[model samples]
Target chain A: MKKLPEWHRIRIIDNPVIRQALVIAGIIYLFWSMSSLDIDWVRVGKGFPRAANILAHMFPPDFSRWQLLLRGTIESVQMALAASFFGMILAIPVGICGATNLAPKPIYLAARAVIILSRTFHEIIIAIFFVKIFGFGPVAGVLTLTVASTSFISKMLAEDIENMPSGQLEAVRATGAGFFQFLNYCISPQALPRYLGVSIYRLDANIRHSTVVGIVGAGGIGQVLAASFSRYDYDFSMAILLTIMSLVFLGEFFSNWVRSQLR
Target chain B: MSIILKITDLTKTYPTGTKALEGVSFTVDKPQVVAIIGPSGAGKSTLIRCINRLVEASSGEVLLGNTDILSLNSRQLRRARRQMGMIFQEYNLVERLTVMENLLSGRLGYVGFWTSYRRKFSKKDFADAFELLERVGLSGYQNTRADALSGGERQRVGISRALMQQPDLLLVDEPTASLDPKTSRQIMRLIVELAHERGMPALVNIHDVGLAQAFCDRIIGLTAGKIVFDGSTRQITEQVLTDIYGEEDWSSTIRKIEEENEVGAE
Candidate 1:
């Protein structure tokens, strides 16, 4: 065989010398950082006693205030339900508008910008902002989760719409269906199963987020957990945490049931 | 002959600067079934789509009946498109929808969004859809989802959806590309028979010369974005086939297919 050409011989990963140097540098940095930061093992040992005390107080989780805990949990679920409902409704239009294949360039760009902006901030931060605007209550929690729901659901939905096969869409348009009319038939049916799946996922995530937002004085079970913790009522805090976990599990079971029923 | 579609100096250049069609001109007259045959990427699809203004032409005039399709506004384009029924190569049905819903989608142009959303199809339209399913040999599959159907079966549904439009002209793009040869012939025969019965003109884009010759009244051959031949199927000589597909070994290709068929039979 003839000698190989320069390009054929030159692979990016063929530079073993540079690769070895990078690995050595990474190892050196890891050891150096560990040495520079002095960690006191005895001081860390003290944290265990406080943890043990809190654990000791958490036994048999007080349910005397069961009615109050149940009310807060119901509020959180209601917030998630309201948010998921409106978010999915609004997301359908927004997602379709943002899909690069479905909408004009400017409209797609604008919709994308809105989705990105909503996603940039965490739900807690959004809740704080809504609390300032709408005043602290379940209203703020609902608004925060609704905005969060739109960001995730709309972005994923837009991606789904974008990734869809163009042949069916073209066939629909060929028969004289307008853009909105096309959505009612082709996009609606094609995206329904996946859309329902994503919506259920968002609903589950929103419920979890709603619990956390309550710590910031947005209404939910998290507020109850935070208040109980601050008052040294670890048993009540344990009860709230268990309730939140149970809620999450229930949502998961429901979402799976809905997915199974789609076909 | 009365001309239903007239193309004048039609051209299409994609944004990437690929010239899919040159200044090509052809007219589809009356209820004649015409076939567009060419090698892959030789502008057969572009030529077929340009008539319906599906692929926007860079420069041209496409007259559907008397109205210049390219000159129509968005509203008028929708009206024009309603008169043209399209069949896809992949049998492009909305996969999750029931067959009846897919069939009713053909009337989406005539009905508004809300009417179609509620499935308020007129009694006659619903009746016609049922009749069409039977005509396409898929009567019992009305409630079945499109994704559940086989390739040939889906194409039959594709045919039903197009016919339900009660289109004046059929725009077929490779109706049998994915089907087995026997099914391919059956589909072509069904399409031709349906068009003949309705007196609807049809422009079919096909890759197989043999299939085109078998079903179509007139054949238009394209090479490198230009029409090299346009005539009756009887006039398509072996030399013309070679010219269209660029040195294609037609005899050998046919022999290989025959050999495959013999193996399949065995």
Candidate 2:
């Protein structure tokens, strides 16, 4: 019988010396970053009791201002829906322009720039900016949600269009169809299901963000919740929190049902 | 017979320095069904695509009934494309659309954009789609989505969609590359029969030499971006196969054709 040569498993990095040096450098960096943070252990120890007191005051949630809570929640829901409608209207053209297969290079770049610009700032910051411009109202909240939703939906939609198989679109083009006609027959049908799914998910996300945007005086349930906290009205704040929780649960259930139906 | 399609000095060189086709040329008379057979990467698919400008030729002239297709601008090229019907290897149907809508999509060039967008095709287009669907043996499948059908059923729909254009010529690229043996023959027969029925010429790219010999009237064998053999099925000797596909034991391949000939003779 012939003797076999010894073998060894291959290393991820072929050079063992460089690999060891990289691992050591990474470990040292992790430890240095961890030790650099300033800690106030004594203050952390005092926070437990304060948190417990807040929880105790939050119990036995009051419903005395149920009508006011209801009105604030309705306003938030209205902002979410209106923003979703307008954002989707804006997103369709922007997504079409952003798709590498569908649009010219210059237009694709411009559309991508717009989406990036919208996504750079957080919704709360944008709401503050809009509040300063439009005064304290639901209008600012609506504008903030619209901008946020447009970027999210348009980016997802452009990726979906880009991932579609080119053969189907090529077949449509071979039929000598006009550009718009080809879009209507070929691109729309292929894109409809994914676009529907993404749009519903974004609407759910927008609803959640609408509540947060109102903390900056943009007019929603969150504003009421924030005011109650400042005034030490913990029970009323608890009622507003419960209402927000129920609304999120409803949005989640509705979005899931719609997505399943799309399938 | 009048010439329905002509190609003169067609060449295609990719940007990466791969020459896919070099100085390829051919012509088809009315009602003729020509089969292009070769090994993989032999420029068979590229030849068919160049005729329709799907893959732009490096330098060539495609004279489709006196108009040089490559010379036409975008608008004129679109008008020129209307006269040419192309079938693909993958049966590239929009999977989410219904069979009737896929069929009606062929008439998009003639109808207004808004008209087709509303799905309000003219009555004449609808009647034609129905008739083509029946002729392709898919009579009651108008409402079925393209993805729901079997492979053979999808190819049937693919053929019907191409015919719906009412084209003057047909360019088929590997129409049977994905089907089982029996389905491949059925599709090949269907394509040739339709071309004859319409009195139009068809250029088909195929990998199966046996099927090509069985269905097509003329065979063009290619190797390494050049045409090595162009003749009838009867003229395909073993030496010719070796020359086109490189040296090999071609006895089994040739014997199959003789057996088919015996069956036909009987």
Candidate 3:
């Protein structure tokens, strides 16, 4: 047989020794973290039966306080609706200002800062803050989800606007269309569908977050669930949980239908 | 023939330090179609875009029917732009909009923001749009989304959209660059026909010498961001092609135009 030429595959990290050292460090860190956790096997063994006992008590959900449950659920839905409506309205200008291709440097920076600040904190943390200011009601939930949804919708919308094809916009500009006219005629037609789809998705997400905000005393189904837990009313809490799950399921279905129609 | 467009020493140096055009000047006094033929990166696109101030000239004047387009403020520029229609290589239709909406968008300059937003265009604008659509051979495609059309059909829509503006000057940048040879010829024919029919001056940047010679009344050749040849179509020879596009087998390029002329004459 003829002599074969040697071949070597290129690697992402070209330095073999450094690559090996990094891999070794990763493995060691993984093991160290695992060992550092105080895993009490005896406590874990007891937790299963305790959990099973809770599950047993959770069954046969009580419908005696159905009116209270319905009111709380309705409050959550209203919070979600208000949040989605306000968030969508606020997101338009913020999203347009944030798009690097559209806005000047200062405006782009300001809009981006708003987006980053809104995104930095978790929705529950925001809900806690709003609850502090708004004094325990669905107002806090609405405000909290509004901030969350605005950030999300604005960020996604800015990205979509930045990525749009410039040809259509250029053609519109060539027609001597004013800035706002160009926006309505060309940019709107291109960005509207995606914007609406993202808004609907944010609305669905807000529905789920509405229940969580109530745990912080922001007033929703979660507040009632927390009360039921405190009172040892596990059956009622179970019913509330089921209601939340169904609300989320219905929201997902509606969002999916709307998105499909948009497409 | 009166002075329609008089470009004086137009120049464009991109931020990246590329000199796309240098002291390029031209005059189009008649309602005739002029073709700009050049190699890639020879400032053909930059030159045409400069006439409408689309690509801002570094320091120069573009006189469109006695108005110094380069000196206009943004508001004045928007008003000035209404006189010049532009066609693009990619058609540039808002793909999500229906064909009628795309066509009516040309009237965006004449209408108010809220009026255009509500899509309540004037009846005359709608009538003109329908007529332009019929002229472009896409009469019944008003309800179709722009994305659904073929390339040629989209170009037709693009042409009509520009025409809907009632522009006095037509600026075409590689209008048929994306089309096949036959479709390109058809589009070129349509553009030239429309320009003559409306008595509008047109400046077309084309790559195909044969098509340019066949349709355009005059030819302007560019090389290295400078105008090398400017005369009637019959004035272009193999030597001129060599001067514009560098040395190659000029015989075939020149022969193709001759064959086209023969076919055209017959």
Candidate 4:
């Protein structure tokens, strides 16, 4: 080579101008938002004595509400299971349709539309909407979580399918496998472990979502906790929080076990 | 020997306008083992795939047995595909599936959808699968996951899977490209012998002219998306190899011959 080009000598980190500008902008934006906020540290500080008083009253979580807590937790788990099962079943076809290599352009766009629509709203917002329609209960919780789970699972599953080796699909096609048959054999086997991995993840997410949906009067222990918080029954609220944490922990362990077995 | 597969003026032009096959036509009759030989981009794969309508011929008629396969509707094509089996250089067995499951997938066209889905294949399907496993010398490896297999073993499963279809015609695409020369010869012999035993015609797309000539009854040489030579293997000469490979060493051909003689002597 006669000489190294000037452009070749330019290192990526040579220009910190844009990076410095972004950091300055972010700092200014954060200060501006902080000024506009409703946070009052003095009020929060004053509430701590009340918090300590309630903390003292919370003496070992009341066993009187234990049966109610158990039933609520069981309902939440059932909702999670139902939503996960239906959502994952629906997601399989949607994921297949969204895969660019497998589905036609129109079908892929339609499947993507479903996923986008499902994902556009937060689970709590969807829960509120479903509660309005379904008149509040586990039904709304199930429906909301179903939409959330479908959106999450289908998008990731579609990506996994898109990444599968085309040769394996061709081999199945050469065997004369029809669309569903080919999906069942060639694509399913390839995508399954990943799907299971994602499904378990989604199940864990759905379980967590079930608890939040109850705050919107959808169902589960969250309704009781929200009520206790509103009524200033901080001890009962503490009990609910502890139960929710344990439930989440248990769900996580169960899903991890399922994922390990799948692997 | 009756006409098994008849292709007339087959052509494939990609959307990007790279013409892969230009009006290529050939016919396979009876149980003859034929190999299509050419350089890398000679459309050997395109030609083989076109027969099964896998690549979808831009313009052609492919008659498999008595039926013209190109005109078949989706449903009819699915039925028509049952009679044809394809083996790939990469083996293409679903890696997560068991070898037995891969073999049973060959009969998916015949099994009911639910039956196949539940993997509760018919007793006849199971029996035939076990028999094929034994025939392919993979009797004890049926329960083994396909991904666990070596290259040669995977191709053996690929072969058994194809045979499980009980196809009347077999399409092989560069079956030995990924194999060692010795393993290549063994795989070729397995395919040839299996074709003979099943009395089904086999069409192989191969790069090695020496291997093609050693096993195949007929050799069709393609160059740049067109057929440059089509003749019996006995009629092929070093000149034809020159026409196909385009000024590569013929010395490798001599070495291949000596290797074959040594194998024969052993």
Which pairs, if any, clash in model 4? none
Task: Looking at model 2, give its docking quality level.
Answer: medium
Model 4 Cα lDDT, one tens digit per residue, B1-266: 67888888888998999899988888787688999989888899998888888888899889988999899998899888888999999999999999998998898888778988999988888899888888778889988999999999999999988888889999999999999989998999999999998888899999887888789889898888888898887677668788887886687785676677579789
Candidate 4 displacement at residue A174 in angstroms: 1.6
Give the candidate number with the greatest TM-score: 3
Candidate 4 TM-score to native: 0.89
Stretches of candidate 3 exceeding 4 Å from the true structure: A1-46, B259-266
lDDT of 1 by residue, B104-194 (tens): 9899889887888899999999999999998999988989999999999999989988888889899999999999999999999999999
Query: What is the DockQ ranking, best to worst?
Result: 3, 2, 4, 1
Model 1's A-chain: what TM-score? 0.89
Q: Write one digit per residue (lDDT tens) for candidate 3, span A126-192.
A: 9899888989989888999999989999999899989989888789998889988887887788899
What DockQ do the predictions score, one after another? 0.70, 0.76, 0.81, 0.75
Q: Write the per-residue lDDT of candidate 2 for residues B62-140, one digit (tens) a residue.
A: 9998889999988888888878888999999999999999998888777788888888988988999999989989999
| Chain A, model 2: TM | 0.87
C-alpha positional error of residue A88 in candidate 4 after TM-score superposition, expressed in Å: 2.6
Worst 10 residues of 2 chain A by lDDT: A33-42
lDDT of each: 0.89, 0.90, 0.91, 0.88
Given the true complex, what DockQ would model 2 score? Answer: 0.76
Off by over 4 Å in 2: A1-38, B262-266
A94-135 in candidate 2: lDDT tens per residue?
999999999999999999999999999999999999999999
